[model samples]
Target: MLPALALAVAVTVTAPPAAHARTGPAPSAAKASKTAKFPPGFLWGVATSGFQGEGSFPDSNWTRYVKRKATGISDPYEKSVDFLHRYPGDIKLARNLGANVFRTSIEWARIEPRPGVRDPKAIAYYDDLIRRIRAAGMRPMITLDHWVYPGWVADQGAWDNPKTQADWLRNARFIVDRYKHQGVIWITFNEASAYMYKELTMRPMDLGQLAAMRTAIVKTHRAAYDMIHKIDPGAPVSTNVAYGTALNGIFDAALFNEVTDKIDFIGIDYYYGANAENLTAGYALTGEFWKIDPEPEGLYYVLKSYQRRLPKLPVYVVENGMSTDNGKPRPDGYTRSDHLRDHIYWIQRAMADGVKMIGYNYWSLTDNYEWGSYRPRFGLYTVDALTDPSLARRPTDAVATYRSIIANRGVPSGYVPVRRPGWCSVEDPVATCFGTTPTPPAAYRIPAR
Candidate 1:
């Protein structure tokens, strides 16, 4: 997930040439017909992380970070959504969406609060969580690390310490051995680049320390991939990348490139997009994600780019969603339902164009603590983690839209996007705008319902 804090990293923006203007009529109904169906057995799911969604967090780097009153956290981390206790009901909510997958992470801090000490209670909690997810007829996609480490680990310099690799592997082996029989898909790391960036944001790191942390992340992912496969043969494992628009190649080179041979699938987490006409992604610099315009059509280009690079591996959209300010209506009048449908439309288009797309998990099931703030809401069911006493999971407009999409395996046949494709998308400017990329079926906009 993109960090909900000011990002110091610079984005490389490429200005498209003037000749790339969108032209031509909408594709014939015959061409657009292919966008209505998905391949059989595509996984549909919702995603949440241990630190972000599951509250009652154990002693970890994040818990410690939030404790610093100057972090500018919008709301105190008060048992965020309390998924630690409310997971049963949450699982039922996901199952109701007709989803076949449920993605989440195991809190390393909770499981191993001390060096070499394993918490039985934490193990039991995760065991029941996985069992309940399976009972609800959804496959569990478990992430080994979601950017939080045991406070003890932090006391010893976190990932900058060379010994941390062994500790991380030990935890990975334990989790894999315990859950291998639960039919769980494994995610070795979540948004490794973003993880590194978040670490830098919290505390400045020297170049050597940054290098050490990067090496640790790469080595551990490669090691974890092998260990997971050995424990659960044929199990799929990947480290999802937070898709960085024009700098994707450079950002991925840090960790993703090192373990290309190890990943079973290409996991991508795409949110905002940039182009000549749309540059609102800058809002994320100040953690104002809701102000960023979502370019759903850019998903098609992102998938295409990955398919070109690693044609053998299937692509799974591990996270994708639009945020709203405190669950309020968007100024652009773009509802969650509209955003969901538009993104799915592009996914289908990508599949139709022969990208080996396998699955897509919405960013979250309910609004939880987004790194440091509760202001950027990205959930099908909105929960007021800061203001509401009961922490109710109020269904957003996207709930029914998602249920319908899953039931039919895609959007309705004649449905058109509420938002038109942006001109000269930075996701893949050369291919999407300049190169001989075939023109997309021209969009026919319909009033958002």
Candidate 2:
């Protein structure tokens, strides 16, 4: 989940008009044709986090936080989708999607439920999970940490504690050494920026504590990156950044700039887009993600920005998806299939524009506890986590669309995004609003409604 407060801050900051003056015409139709197809072996995958998708709650900071009535969570964390016991069936759903990569986090809380003791049962569970993923013909992309930590860490002042860095690296090194030979892609931390924002929201903290936490997070990631490379040698590792609108650079610089040399690739999670006219994004602050319009075209600008910043590193859309409130139909009638295709269309455009994009993962495989609520469903398969005791995984409209996409490598040759690019999109003001208007091939444009 992205921090809506960050988006609110981005809305107030705008680039100067002259800073992005167009110097030439947009790409020609002929150029688009040359890059319509995805390169061979592009990674098509689904993403889930340990705490968000997995059920059977363990003692963790999040579990404790949600217990407080003041948190105002819409629902209780009732064995969320029960992924702890049902991973095999979920893995089957991803396999049926033709996915080559299955991304999930190794829960620090579960692995080390206590201060220093490691649970063998937790280790065995993840061992089998990775084995199944590999046997099903997919590589496992493991996230070492995804915001939730052992309750012991929280009791010790969480990231603000100076001891937290060593403790984090201890668990991280163990996980890396255990799975180093398993053909795994590693993510050191999930949305490091959002994690910090969540800390601010979940609890009251002074600026000094926040700064300490930031420093500790950077040090922990740097150490973890070094340790993973030392153990695995050539495996790719990154800490994904949640893409904030105009404040993206600022938010990313908080941690990314500190360890730019440590990253093997750039992992980005993009959801909503904001522009001068698109104030609807404010709804995300209140957990109303569906009300915010989907802006698939903004993904193109996001990729282009990163390509310009880090020309050599491969970029991956580590997580991207739209959320509907409690699986309800969006008022705009934009189905999940439409959102998936439109986002892929923009990704193809980014690739055409020379961005070194290598992989894309839908946000999740099934609906689970999205932070504090199950209301925001961002899954290819919807699961009634609160109501259904069976916790059945029902396919949404995106299932067939994703299966065909992975099998075909991308959307068809003449595909255009269902959602057109907004005027002066804040995603990359210099590239969009202030610069030359991007024009798709005439064959790809759909008539305005």
Candidate 3:
């Protein structure tokens, strides 16, 4: 599996360029009011994960994958941004940015290193981290699993084993019981389909093995949701879906639909969007990290589509941000601040149209190990963990912009987008090809679909 994936990655690098743009009708002006506002008590935050940000890694599947010979020419995962030791300072940076929520994963590998054996020291570490988040005037948004698990669990056939599910619930129940009083939002799993894809691609998993893993994940999520509410009745629980442009409908049918009723709210992590003309997102599929095109307005279409699909549940942008090549400016000259403001404009646009949107968390507070490489920087503050010895967190252009956005609740009323809506956006093709006039208060379906 590893060698095959390596060859696939090699093909992407050598393959001829894909058609990333298309000619279409002239771009249309967004129909949102200039003074649109988000709903009251909306969450504004930044997100990070343990394996990506935290330096010290436990012996989990990802570490083994990285160490494997077939990975070929990837950067060594050296103390990734050192979030484990520097979280206090980093949390302070987030607080100073005027963010009201800070998202991080409580790594299952660290908390329960061995089956039925809890790590008191690891538990205490989270205790302090959660308190620091609240002390800094920010609410904690904890993710139970962010694609990493205990090494022991991995040895037991991963999700394919019945014991894996039992072990997962045991750990999840303990987490619910321990952190119920924190008054936090819960994420059962992050990017479920993405996780499955990675697992199947890198590990030697047959179709049956893949099916078993996915089934176990959904079962674990449903059980976790019930357990969380049993501890905190008012707690909102969800497993964030990574909304793929033109592919979300399939993603929803495959994994998201089963847990819809179990989820209290919908969590979406949308980063890249494609259209008839622009397929720069093709780069993402082929491992071309530098070839992304930003389409902030596409976020509006994503929120609206989900809002229509799940009218009763509120939606939160659990993770959204732009990535640049190795912390450098884009050749297109789009800045980080520009991406943030433009995306927020669409969020407000969706809200004004009655999408029941509630929250937005930037992809990360500081750049860390982006899965296999640190080259795709997606942080309000850039940290060069690979080269910089001090690992200093340097503020970027987005910091001041985010600070003001949070302080004002959103962008100013008269603010127009940095870029206009793209033509026939595949993010929501039916809506974009037709029109985006706000749906009536009594109705929230995509128009002309």
Candidate 4:
């Protein structure tokens, strides 16, 4: 299976760049205001993941994936951002920037390292993390799953087996019961559909394997949703799904239709590019990440698509930022400041068009693993994990710019975003703003008469 997956990874890595690329805690932070009028409630937060940012945890599937030769991720999962120890430092950094919410995930693999045994130490770690959230005056948004699972569970049956859903429910119930008092945002799963296919596509899976994965994902999400509400009836639960280009949205729809009745809110994650060929209902998307370049106008199109369908629920720029291979200025002498400023301009335009929008969370405060390498840097505070020894976090030009945006409540009227907004490629990839280059839709074919 892994050898075949290695071949798949080789294929994707070799493919043309199409498109690419959440959280923790309240130091304590929801509704964003409407156009011109901010919502009655607004959520301002930064996001992280336990497996990605938390260091010093025991081995899990991702840990193995990172270490494996085919997976290609470096550094072997040691002391990632040292957030396990220095989250306070990062949380403090977010607080200083005027953020009102901190988002992070609970690693099930860590919380339930062994099948039946719960880790007391892991529970304590999260207890401390939640307490810190309340202390920081930020609301906590806890994600139940963020694409990492226990190595043991993987051994038993990943999503391909029926038992995985039951196992997941056990863990979900434990989490909701344990953290009920946090009054936090409950995210049942983070980009489940996206991860499932990406993982399978990463390895190669037959239709039967694909069917099992899809079935298990929907069932698992539904089970977890019920568990969250059953344990804490009032807790608002949602699933944060990746709302990417056509390909990503199609993959993210698994839980949307199957478990629509089980959620309080649907969290949609939107990143770079402006193509709207494949949005699904019941699951509203949060602009996960957007930049001024490569696809600045794509951000505008993203909000516009939501306005057309998800107009009532305010949009949250859940994640958005830029990545420089070498921390250099943007192509047009655009600094990080230009990138953010430009994206905000389209955000304002979206607001004018009556998009119920709320908060905007930066992609990250510091750079970590870009899945495989340190080359793809995306943080307001840059970490030299690849080149710098101190692992120190340093601010970029956008740090001050973001502080100003949070303080001012919006970008200035005269402030020009780095680029102009462009048309959305609903059924065409090459029809995008930055995508003026014509590439036919992947699924294009003539229908029978």
lDDT of 3 by residue, 52-156 (tens): 999778788787777772232277786999999999999999999888889999998989888788889888988899999999988899999998888888898
Using TM-score as the measure, which candidate wins? 2
**For residues 131-189, could you state the per-residue lDDT of candidate 2 as single tens digits?**
99999999999998888998899889898788889998999988999998888999988
| Best of the two (1, 3) by TM-score | 1
Distance (Å) between predicted and true CA of 135, model 4? 0.6
Return the lDDT, model 2, position 399.
Answer: 97
Q: Between 1 and 4, whose lDDT is larger?
A: 1
Report the lDDT of model 2 for residue 9: 46
For each candidate in turn, the TM-score is 0.91, 0.91, 0.89, 0.79
In angstroms, how far off is 119's CA in candidate 2? Answer: 1.2
**What are the runs in model 1 whose C-alpha is more than 4 Å off?**
1-33, 70-72, 435-449
Clash tally for model 4: 34
TM-score, candidate number 3: 0.89
| Residue pairs with backbone atoms closer than 3 Å in model 3 (clashes) | 20-279, 21-277, 22-277, 34-413
User: For residues 224-276, what per-residue lDDT tens digits would candidate 4 score against the true structure?
Assistant: 77777777878777776565554444444445545656666546565555334
lDDT of 1 at 117: 91
lDDT of 3 at 373: 81
lDDT by residue (tens digit), candidate 1, 1-449: 23322221221122221232232222222244467387779899999988898888888888887888434465678799999999999999999999989999998899999888999999999999999999999899999999989999999988888889999999989999998877788999889877877786675565556666777888899999989999999889999988877656546765777788999899999998887668888777688999888888778777777777788999999999989999999987888998999889888877877788888999889999998899999999999998888999999999999999998889887676777666667876654455442334445443211
Q: Which has the greatest lDDT?
A: 1
